[model samples]
Target chain A: MPIACEETGRALTVRVEGEIDHHAARQLMEELSRRLDAALPKSLTLDLGGVAFMDSSGIALVLRAYRRMVALRGSVTLQNVPDQAAKVLKAAGVDRLLPWNE
Target chain B: MKPVNEAKLTFWSRSANEGFARTAAACFAAQLDPTLDEVNDVKTAVSEAVTNCIVHAYPDQLGLIVLRLRLYPDNTLEIVVKDSGVGIPDVDQARTPLWSTGGADRSGMGFTIMESFMDAVKVRSRPGKGTTVTLRRRIARRFPG
Candidate 1:
């Protein structure tokens, strides 16, 4: 997984590319958490336009990111969700828990 | 029903193998000429099954995992994932959505995902004997353009 972070004032945009599975989620989570801690932005947006596939592991990763933002008193949003990832998120009902843009 | 074609793969239970397992299953299913959606569904279901083996079945150490693929004359694909690790004592509770022993990072929706993506999912396990998940889906045959 390749993750890129862009900081624009108080908001941070994270672009995640490639597959999200049990194998990749760990590294993705660690990298995302590290970036989140370093930025500590008031608003976070995860860009998943480049994601090709995701399973239930993506749901957990998103929830963790959401909880971290909640703990930090920040807001988080998911954008550009691909069709494959959307199906998994929807099946797990995680799509309703957070704000996501198709 | 007898399968027209079949194959089996045996590998160690490692998280890194999750992608390999799913991709292998998808590749095996490709012969059916399934649609993109059908292919994704198989990939997702296989990922969940293999993930269970990696995360729960062999939580403590590495173990063997076997994946079996079969093709039916009816354009159906059958996949079997077996792990000889610690088996689930209560399959019912384990099948419940959002029920997970896997820590904070796990959503515990593996079974649900498998059920949703596959036409049928059957799990058979015994304590200390290991677990086997059988998934089947009928691929839609596309008409000639």
Candidate 2:
């Protein structure tokens, strides 16, 4: 996976590309954790527009990030999730907890 | 008739298992006459099952996950995923929706998705032994004149 981050005030927007399966999930989580810990962003937004495939592991990654942000008294949002990935998230009810931008 | 062509592979109990499973399913489906969406459902279900083994089965320990694929002439595919880790203590509770052993981030919907996507799913677990998950899907047959 490819991850790029941009900071706008206290919010950090992370753009992730490539497939988010089990192999990439750990690396993605570790990288995100490192960035989030250092920047201490008040909010984190994940851009999934470039993602082509995602499994339950991807959902786990999102949930992990959300929990981390919540613990830090922040929040996490999902953006541009494709229909396929969105289906998995919706089934997991992740859409209810984390705000999404279409 | 010959039994369904079978292929087997074993991978280390790592996160890569999920990728291996998904890719294998996709590749196998491409050789058959299944729709893209049907293929994707098969891939996703196998990916979830393999991920479960990587995360919950061995935890941090290094182990092996065995995968078997069978393609029947009737357009049915069977996948078996097996791991020899600390088996699930309670299969009944584990299959419950939203009942995850992990933190809040875990939705505990892995089994649910697998069952929903595949035509059949059977899970066998023995607390000190191991766990094996079998998933099968029937390829929609084309009508003949």
Candidate 3:
């Protein structure tokens, strides 16, 4: 899995590619944590456009990111979630907490 | 055992494999006349169960993770995920929500997700032996629009 982060003003956009499963979840979390710690953006936007698949492990990642951003007094948004991934997220009621575009 | 119209794959005990497993399950379920929602649920549930095995089953040694999927004649799909690693000490506590033995971050939601999405989920484990998770989903015949 590859995660690229770009900071546009106060919003930090993260582009995640590949699968987000148990093995890859930790690495992705660590990367996000590190970047969040360093950049400390006021808002975090995740671009899931390139994400091919996501499991429950992906939900944990999303929850962790959401909570962290909330603690930082920031907001989290998801964009371009795949249909399969969106289904899981919606089932988990994650969409209720995090706003998503398409 | 010969798989009944089934497909199997093995991946390194890694997270990327979880994605592979989910995609495989989705594709396999799509072969039936189920809606996209049903297929997604099967995929998510399988992924959750498999991910649990990857995270908890093998701690030190990295071994093979086997995903066996079979499409039954009754339009029911069964997925069996096995890991020959350290098994769960207590099956009861493991299934409890927020009862993670892996500290705070881990919410112990794996079994919960499995139970929620699939029609049936069976977990068998023995400490120092291994772990196997069986998930089943039945797809109802869709009516033509």
In order of TM-score, best first, we have 1, 2, 3
Candidate 2 regions exceeding 4 Å error are A71-75, B1-3, B102-107, B142-145
DockQ of each: 0.86, 0.46, 0.38
State the lDDT of candidate 1 residue by residue for B1-145, as single tens digits: 7899999999999898999999999999999888899999999999999999999999999999999999998888999999999999999999999999999889998999999999999999998989999999999889644
Angstrom error of the Cα, residue B69, model 1: value is: 0.5
TM-score of each: 0.96, 0.85, 0.81
| Tens digit of per-residue lDDT, candidate 3, span B1-145 | 4445988878777766777788788787787878877877887788777777766886665778999889987788999999888999899889886467654345467787788888998999999888899998888877634
Local distance difference test values of all predictions, in order: 0.93, 0.84, 0.81
Model 2, B1-145: lDDT tens digits are 4436888888898776677778887787666678877887888898888888887888879789899888888788889999998899988888887788855435588898887789999999997678999999988875633
Please list the residue runs of candidate 3 whose C-alpha ends up more than 4 Å from where it truly belongs after superposition: B1-16, B23-30, B33-35, B102-107, B142-145
Q: Write the per-residue lDDT of candidate 3 for residues A1-102, one digit (tens) a residue.
A: 489989989899999998776767778888989889988889999999888767766777888888889899999999999987787677678899888987
lDDT of model 2 at position B88 = 95
Best by lDDT: 1
When 1 and 2 are scored with DockQ, the better candidate is 1
Candidate 3 lDDT score relative to the true structure? 0.81
Candidate 3 chain B has its poorest 10 consecutive residues by lDDT at B98-107
In model 1, which residue pairs have backbone atoms overlapping below 3 Å?
Answer: none
TM-score of every candidate's chain A: 0.95, 0.96, 0.96
